[model samples]
Target: MGTKEQLLCLLESNRERYVSGEKLAEAIGVSRNAVWKAVNALRAEGYEIDAVTNKGYALSQENDLLSPQGIERFLPRDHPFNLIVRKLVDSTNDEARRRAIEGAPEGTVVVAEGQTAGKGRRGKEFFSPTATGIYLSIVLRPALQADRAQYLTTAAAVACAQAIEHVAGKQASIKWVNDIYCNGKKVAGILTEGAVDMESGCFDHAVLGIGVNVKPPAEGFPAPLGDIAGSVCDADEKALRNRLVAEVLDRFWGLYRHLPDRSFYDEYRRRCFLLGEPIVITRDESRVRARAVDLTEDFKLVVELPDKTRLELPYGEVSTAHA
Candidate 1:
């Protein structure tokens, strides 16, 4: 933490009472003048730290940014992952890929406040604006093989939904592969990409990129999506980012450890919204519209067609009709 952040934390911890400048200086091992400067810096950042000469400073209740410190305060005391926070990046997934190549351990997470080149499924460019949402990626090396890779996306969806519910106290339904929806509007998205060395028994790593539009757009949503997409904090800038991040990490830690358990599979299947719903699978020229029925543990989709014929499709092959 920087000097300003340390001072902010001290004032926030003592929000109920005013802490004297001399006491803050002694606690933070800095001069009283240094503490005063730090308080000034914090106040500039939209924090309501009231500096009363001789009496000391008080952090007035103010808007909190979705920065590292705000997010970290909500995390468990001993989290499994480090908060590798960055101001801006081309992509968090890209950063995680670089770290994974350098022999980074599992559970390493890379979070960027903004991404200039965010990506979605099938190389689609996703829009990520500054401090408007969560742009993060988690690095993992699951024991499953390529055939079972899509389940990671499913695991991610359930974790996200559970986290959202924990934060918003509202349930979110999963959209087949990598999207989470609430009130029939898009709220979150996940992208899972990994590489494997064919000769080696172990896989390289997989990076799950997640982006949630927390606040409603000020501008620049694609023309086609203007009427459909919405954010959780569209009405409130002070969104559920902090709580959701904590809940997501907590949920993932539990599931990742017991991934081989059948209960994990059961839980994911139960939350799949596409199952038993009418859907369309359009791949360029071919479109197969049917009722989505089941998703195997290996992440294959079994759909029953209009003619009562059954088609077993891979989860990778389709998009669904609107909810």
Candidate 2:
């Protein structure tokens, strides 16, 4: 890591108290001049750092800028993540896909504070305002057949929901296939995209993209999403974004390693708000009304049609009939 990165980790770890320049220099094996330079650089990048003449420098407790070091401070020292953070991007998923095509390994993560063209399921626009949301994507090379790739999306939903609850102290629910809800409104969405090796019938690589509304936008949600969108929390706590990113990766990594076991299936089913509710299934141009009855072992939605015919939906879009 560069001097700036080393300094960031140290500051984030000691965010609660100020550390003298001499102490920081000694801890990181750098000179006081270098420490001062790094502090200025961090401030240039939008970090809030306070400098005191005798007490020294301290990272502000309210600093919410996203950084690899900030996220790494909460991650395991040996975690297998190649994290990249951007002030802005067109889309984290698009960036991850490009890296995957260029031979990026598993655990490569792309995170953006804001996106110009955030993507959602079925190519819909995901509202991703700056400084109030988390938009990230992970590149995975799972050893699964093409037919079972949906499991990745389902697993991610469970992971994200668990992370939101743990970090934000809020109850989160899953909306059928790939949405996460809080307080009866959508708070996050996951979109999994991948390519299958035609010869082997297995995935070449999969980019699992997740977008979360950590706090409401300053101007509030757009008119179309005002009724359906919500945030994980109303208070924008410092380090909230960094902690959330690490927690999500940590939880997802555990579930991903045990993909063959499908242990997360139970949690996904339990949190699914659509189960037992009357829903409208949309496939292309046709729509049908059904009551969500259960979830199959493979995470398929088992719904009973109006005629009392049960059907297992391997994949499709669904919404509450009253939505």
Q: What are the models' TM-scores?
A: 0.88, 0.97
- The digit string of per-residue lDDT tens for model 2 on 96-197 reads 999999999999999999999999988899998889999999999999998998789999999999999999999999998999999999999999999899
Candidate with the greatest TM-score versus the true structure? 2
Off by over 4 Å in 1: 8-19, 41-62, 237-239
**Candidate 1, after superposition: displacement of residue 141 in Å?**
2.8
* lDDT for each residue of candidate 1 in 1-323, tens digit (9 for 90 to 100): 77777876676557657899999999899998999788777667656667676778875544445455556666777777866877789999999999988988898888877899988888877778876777889899888676666767777888888887778766788777778888777778898888887876445798888888777667746776666566765555444565667678778777777766634667677777789778888777798788888987666788888899997777555556653
RMSD of 2: 1.2
**Cα-based RMSD of the predictions, in order?**
2.7, 1.2
Lowest-sum lDDT 10-residue window in model 2: 233-242
lDDT for each candidate structure: 0.76, 0.93
